[model samples]
Target: MPSNKAELAVRIAAAQPGDSVRGLFFKTVFSLIQQHAGPAALESVRVDALATNYSDLRTYPVQDFLTLMYRAADVLEATVGPENAVFHACGETGVTRYATGPGMLIFGIISRGDPQKLFAGAQMGYSAAVSYGSREYLSTGPKSGTLRVRRDMLPPAYHEGILTGALKVLGLKGTARAHAHDIDRVDYDIEWG
Candidate 1:
């Protein structure tokens, strides 16, 4: 999995040189900040920790990306409200548009957000499709499934919003409930009928 991730990062770097692992996310994030917190506040954001150039397509330490994201979450929570605002903030701004071309076409053919197929894609190292630190398929029923997304390092609010937005994009009516087993992991019960 790590190899696959590294390969993808390499491809991304090659495709868009002078960009960070954050890639398109950098512009979108700043745009969101500007909208939610005003341009002045956006300017105050120290994005340097993530990378010297937000537009630079260079491989950066994953921890730096995480720190920048958590800080963005703080900004959104304070400016946009705490209830998954970061997710909604990004979702409403068309973050999933990043999944362009064949990648999304396949997902669209799968009837949008089918957990089973999505999981398969993630297992195949298609993190852009559906990502988690380390996920385990716990229980899958005819109409629902449970995904144990370990590495609760990132806030659930972040995932919850992204999950909801992704499902919605696929035209799937679903609800996700996140259970924090420990600070290190979370169990998400995603239900659809």
Candidate 2:
């Protein structure tokens, strides 16, 4: 975990070049901060860390989102526990919010209550969400698959939360283990009913 604000800033500055995330994520995280820590905390993160206001119609740099996520995790960690746990829950909520909202119709039609389709459809979802990285879901068996992501901007735990959240929202029992090959790469081994 980042030991202090400066460390966090350095981490954000280290984000990959030319990477950006959709504005919906900004709105989602702002809502998360407001829900967990209140308006003041949200405002602080927005102005101090993000250096901008939330806008659902524009894309923001990956570093800005990282700052928001890390700062939000720091604020909510006291109430939510460890940093990983906070990020995990945030990931879960992020995906849940998106999957149930703007992404609803498309994901619903693509997934059709099937995990395989959901996994395959995730690539499209990823494309719609971020301007960097690539996600590929390869089936290993009838009930298992590997979700490989390259140049991922988020932490491994966050992606783990994403996989689990996706399964949960689909009402499937499952497990997802994240394999972080490097800061920019991760592979998820997933099994579901």
Summed backbone clashes in each candidate are 8, 0
- Whole-model lDDT per candidate: 0.53, 0.79
Off by over 4 Å in 2: 1-14, 49-51
Find the 10 residues in a row with the least total lDDT in model 1: 1-10
Error of 2 at 2 (Å): 5.9
Tell me the tens digit of each residue's lDDT in model 2 across 68-124.
Answer: 788888777766667788778778888888797666864688888788889987778
Tens-digit lDDT string for candidate 1 (13-96) = 322222223345555666787787786667666656643565423244444444555455666667676535664556434335
Name the 10 consecutive residues with the lowest summed lDDT in model 2.
Answer: 1-10
Evaluate residue 143 in candidate 2 and report its C-alpha lDDT on the 0 to 100 scale.
91
Considering every candidate listed, which one attains the maximal lDDT? Answer: 2
Model 2 error, position 166 (Å): 1.2
